[model samples]
Target: MAEHGRRRWRLVLTASPLQGHMSPMLHLATFLHSKGFSITMAHSDLNRPDPLNHPGLTFLPLRDNLSATADFAGAGQFLQTLNDNCRPHFQHHLVQIIDSQKEASASEKESIVVIHDNLMFFAGSVAADLGLPSIILRTSSASFFPAINIIPQLLEQGRFPVQGPNNQILDNEEIVSELHPIRYKDLPFLCTPIEQTLKTINMIITKKPPSAFLWNTFEFLEPTGLTHIRDHYQVPVFSVGPLHKIIPTHSTSFHKEDTSCISWLDKQAPRSVVYVSLGSLANVDEKISTEMAWGLANSNQPFLWVVRPGLVKGFEWFEFLPEDLVNQMKMRGLIVKWAPQKEVLAHSAVGGFWSHCGWNSTLESMFEGVPMLCQPFELDQKVNCRYLSDVWKIGVEIVAERGEIEDAIRKVLVGKEGEEMKQRAIEIQEKVKVAISHGGSSHNSLEAFVDYILSL
Candidate 1:
């Protein structure tokens, strides 16, 4: 903590433009600000947070030629473009902020640190060039972080680039050292071609590791995964998260959230509604979207669904719903473009989450004690879904077929099996609350992190 007569230290924070990445990063900034550090946010123009929303913080929006709507062929390409386009802007603004702080009175110029999203590869370089300490804020699980570090080993063993008879490589359940037992299919960024994979691997491995690695997860939630990272990597690691629980007022959604769904939920019975959303970026084909609609209708369960504008390929928003399907939804469903997700999960009527298992959503559901019906779309979501079902026993994965979807929903919302899952979810929810409270594991870790930043 800063002394009464001394000036507060400043911390500059940056994040990738994506919603999932930006949300947690902002929450972290809020948490640190509450701890007495002056906050400075450096962000790209794409999906930029309104500076007015965060009054005490300094907001720097960096310029980039890339349009927010520019189409990338895939996630890897998008990431590569972000790094290329944002690097100079980020570095330039970062330098300006550091210099500005230096010009402040000696007490106010005590120290400055940079904490950046792990995906913004250029942040580490900028920190080094400026001779400042930095920390990497990993938006995903600690379990998923080491996968990037082991791509070389996987290639040497001929396990990655995942080629084999009949695409059999995806079926092989090999236990990789840093990760839990997983098939090739569960690997993060697996859809990227081998060449792109190598490029990403090189980018990550070549960078100077930051002074500390901060994960948006609690120690108890992923003990084994945390241990693996600490044992293999030399940098200091801190697990100080389920950040939504810590900083609830920080808004991170790129889209305006609809809070009206809470009233609809209030009309339903406890543990009856299945909350459905596919996150901000995942798009489903028309076939899968149609199947999901009918499946939800057939389950005879009330639901609150978020159908983002571009959620379905080649269809207008909710126009893809057939007339009869629309009528059925009117009877038992509520649809919105975007939802106040944390609020929806906390509602009494929500029994389960039908989700893409994005880490933020998963943690939110866990924090609320809502079981999941997982349909993992891509990247770390797949890994998170694996842990939800196999390790945590709080969710069940669903296939895209109507029958499979219906069955999974029925199992989670009605049957004895569903009750068991709900009980487990509630148990985890209690543990999460404890972890974020004072003197809890996550609380202690957060305090330690603050102390480190102040010391520097």
Candidate 2:
């Protein structure tokens, strides 16, 4: 519960422009606002949250470089441009906010703190420069958190840049004992050149670290990973999440959610539909898309597929579904440009998810007790897919071939194997509910986080 008569704390949050980064930060903002703190979202001009979606929070715009709205060039370039360009603008803007607040009457005044997504480390630096406390929010799972710094470790050992025409580290196939069960190949794929990757890594961690890190994960999900982070950082780390369930916030989606898919789902039988979405950034090969369409049709299970614009690389939209198989897919599938994923997952018709294994989608699927057909694309997704399939035993991974795709979808939706996976998922879903309840781990952690903030 929020402390009574303590409404003078104001939080300044910086949200990264990517869809994946924007989401969890906004949910955190909503969660904090409910605890009686005022929120000011300092973000790039592109992909700004709709003020109507979050009524109580304020949105502040920072100047943007052209790269803000352009297609992602690469990981390092994107972060370098965002951090280098936004640093001075954000610093100056924060100074102005601090000065303006000083002029207000004491009764109307509020103390300030800077909280931001992990990628936006520049915010913490700016805050430290002005002598204010700041916090960092990790948008991915706790298990995936420590794996992020692995690239630097590999580089130090002189084994990176993966010799040869194909991308394979010297120890790509070996199980890393320190990482336990994850191979070098399975570490989050850094999409930038080795030098750029090193540069990006150095930039984010070399600064004075934040006061705390707030993870969008709970103890039951990845206790070991959480422990690794606490030992490594030696700072206050809070696991107060599955925040979507804690407080249901309005859509921070970049695309308009197509509600029409819900009606298609309504017409299907219970536990009969396979839901597919590849998230916002992953691009599939044209051949793979064609094969996936045929594979879904071959599975004979009813399915709802989100084929958003740019799903097939170099194409405007997924209009290239082979003219021959179009009729077959129409008979048993509903295709939409986008979907309201949380609602779709909860619907009785959705029995399985064929996903790119993005962290947000992974958490949503887990929350609804739906088994997953994991097809991790890159970066943190590979780490998440590994845990879901190996650690949790609730997901089935698939190769990109049509025959394998069909079999995996069936295994999650209709076969006895799917039933077993569904049961395990249901068990975890129940645990999730308990974690957010009174006196639970996540619940207590949230209380601790609040007290820590108040103390600061």
TM-score of each: 0.94, 0.94
Range of the 10 consecutive residues with the lowest summed lDDT in candidate 2: 1-10
lDDT of 2 by residue, 314-378 (tens): 78776787766888889999889999999999999999999989888888888899999989888
- Residue 236 in model 1: shift from native, Å? 1.7
Reference-based lDDT, residue 309, model 1: 90
Cα lDDT over the full model 1? 0.83
lDDT (Cα, tens digit) per residue for candidate 1, span 1-456: 353346567688889898888888888888887877778888888899987677677887866566767887866677777777777877777677677876788665656678988778777778888898889888788777666667667877877756577764454466665566655677766656777777776765435678888888988898877987777667788898888778755567899999888988989999999999999988899899999999999999999989999889987588977998899888999999999998898888999999999999999999999999999977788888888988899999999998998999999999999999999999999999899999999999999988777666
* Ten-residue stretch with the least lDDT total in model 1: 1-10
- Clash pairs, candidate 1, are none
Backbone collision tally, model 2: 0
Q: What TM-score would you give candidate 2 relative to the actual structure? A: 0.94
Those runs of model 1 whose alpha carbons end farther than 4 Å from true positions after fitting are: 1-8, 97-105, 164-179, 204-207
